[model samples]
Target: MIPISVVVVVLGGWSVLYLADTILKSFNSLKNSYENWLALHGLSIAPFHLRWQTSFFNRVFYKFTERSFKEIFQKFSVGMVFGVIAMFGSMILLAKTLMQTLAQMMEEAPSVQSDHVLQVVSSSSRIFTSRSILLSLKHTQVVVPGINLPVSQLAYFFLAILISGVIHEIGHGVAAIREQVRFNGFGMFIFVVYPGAFVDLLTTHLQLISPVQQLRIFCAG
Candidate 1:
């Protein structure tokens, strides 16, 4: 097998790619207003945007959204930190081990296609083709290539991480909207390969009309 991480990383990675691809492919075909909104701040979605990668799944999961965001984040963040440690040897070990994989995946990945044309190249996610920070997960490697293994182990691993992240950010947005605070924006980020969903806390703070509203948004994400 190609290794467990490979399958999942590819699947998760490509899922984002495919989603972006579909959205981009349909951009011209989409109605003006909707498409325009995406284009206007689409660049802001950089570094992380995997929520759509699991949107339907996220939608169904949120029905169980009775928990506060801070509580959930604290619990899951601790769990993920531990899980990554157990699976990848506290990141340090994983880093030492996957140096080769990193080299290869990157070498194989399209890293040099960036050639700007007019104003378009400077303004778009499709141009970069960088591995999504959200999909760049490490840990749960059940195989070793020539050794043969599947990345399926990382599927659930990533699903949890991804879903947790999506819920975290969306919860922030929902809480903010529900509280009638401004929506400066939210963004995605990556620390190593694990993904993180973060809301614009500073802007959120400024936009919040009151402590109760701020508390609502803060507690949610």
Candidate 2:
């Protein structure tokens, strides 16, 4: 049987999608008018995603990017260094977890007895034991409203995510403009429950830039 929480989540997601589609359709009586309006406003809507993009922030990006070459280089250089360090640290932690899991599996494999085959089989369904990588993961919980998290806190959570996403996109836009790449626009979207923001840069301009400049743009976010 499906859990009540699972059912509620599914129904809620479906309802949100339906409502978004309905609101979009109600904007214009004719399909062409709807399409034209969306195009004119830089709006795009799908079943589970809504994006509104515009070039209004291009000037702001340019202003922010108008820094001394030394300052810009130093900022991105520090960011790149920290990004690399974080990447390597995560890799090392994952590798350690895998090694621990494998070691535990091997230790347990030899203990399986022929007489207790059924018991061993049942337990073997879990490849990673509680003492392994799963030990940490098992305690991690998802922040579901009315469940693990209070419904009132949900707004704060979403707001934090939106702020972080906007800052991340702003960083990318500034880096792109600093690199002399064409900053097209900025957009934000909500996909199901996750909120994200993006900076649109011309693909041709990005491709034409030097590898170091590309690295700065990519790592800016």
Candidate 3:
């Protein structure tokens, strides 16, 4: 039998997807209606409605690594080094911020004894976990945060995933153009506000394209 906790998590995730689709639809409808109203008033519509045009490369480096990652890195050693450094930095910063916040809060509270405050601070993680465990009781509250989080992460990790994901999809589309394969615009998936880039090889997939070519295009993304 599937565990109840696991079932709740899965259903909660699906609800978040539904919420994102609704949000995107509403935004698009509003933009179109507003643009039509502006046309009636003789005001030109604003340019650059692109909320997702984030590019990752500065031409030179992008072309430099156009070849296989194996060719660029020669091995996975450099990537491994970068991954370790990023993780260590994130952990240290998070720990320092958490500690400073807790200390400041304790200093402002004179009625709470230092020992008692320390005990509560140490158990904060336990309290957070318990709150999450109780999430099934208010499923929408749990799901909305899950839905809206990736959009928030995109703002901060813009340098990391947004650029990379865009470049990755563009590389696929460029490859298809090079191979003379029929293609469509780049595909996209917008979840709540969390967007993802995808390659549009729908016709290629249906047609009997060589597995090797498909593999190359897929890997570009």
Candidate 4:
């Protein structure tokens, strides 16, 4: 989870940027200012009928990177397979835990006091053991000021998230394009206060694809 200070900073920045964007839409002068700024940098924004926003920086960088992206995917395909397996294992574990919890609850009956006690104890023991093992493997570090994480680590955290998000989305886009999937567009969004990226793929077409292809597309992210 993000620390409070980091959360505040993100919210504050989004507020400021969103206000500017709104103002740009309403005022011709401001819109020209935005256009001029982008023109100076050889960049542009393509607004869609969605809440998410996206920008194109340089076509040259995109073309070069597009070619390399597929190559990188091919090289890491084996690692990706392992990642998908691990992801599925985690889902199975979660589902099993939930099913066991529900079974324990349904088994509880007032008339069968002795049986209820045994079942509750057994279920509680299993849940606690599984939860403890999961928690033991989990760890977090704070980066926000006044948190467990030091302020100095903020840059590292920011870069980590930015790079991770970009790479993850790139995988989805690359796989979709490689499989000849019809793509609408891609963009970033600030849902409530959290920032994330998304790649738009047609669900109908996605359903038509093979399960192996679908798995590749999802696990790429």
Q: How good is model 2 by TM-score?
A: 0.69
lDDT of each: 0.50, 0.74, 0.49, 0.60
The digit string of per-residue lDDT tens for model 3 on 44-91 reads 311211122212333433444455445533223343355457779878
What is the full ranking by TM-score, best candidate first? 2, 4, 3, 1
> Compared with the true structure, what per-residue lDDT tens digits does model 2 show for residues 1-221?
33578658856886886786677677666667767888899888776677889998787778767755568778987887787788998886776565445444445655454225434434675644443443344333435665676665767888899999999988888888888899899999887666889988899999999987888888887
lDDT (0-100) at residue 74 of candidate 4?
Answer: 76
- Against the true structure, what is each candidate's TM-score? 0.32, 0.69, 0.33, 0.51
Q: Model 4 over residues 11-124: C-alpha lDDT tens digits?
A: 677677666667786887677878677556533333321244334522333554477876845744654697778989988777656555544444464547745555565676
Against the true structure, whose lDDT is highest? 2
lDDT of 3 at 146: 28
Please state the error at residue 195 of candidate 2 in Å.
0.9
Task: Give per-residue lDDT, candidate 2, residue 28.
Answer: 62
lDDT value, residue 200 of candidate 2? 88
Q: Model 1 misses residue 157 by how many Å?
A: 0.9
Best-performing candidate as measured by TM-score: 2
Give per-residue lDDT, candidate 2, residue 114: 27
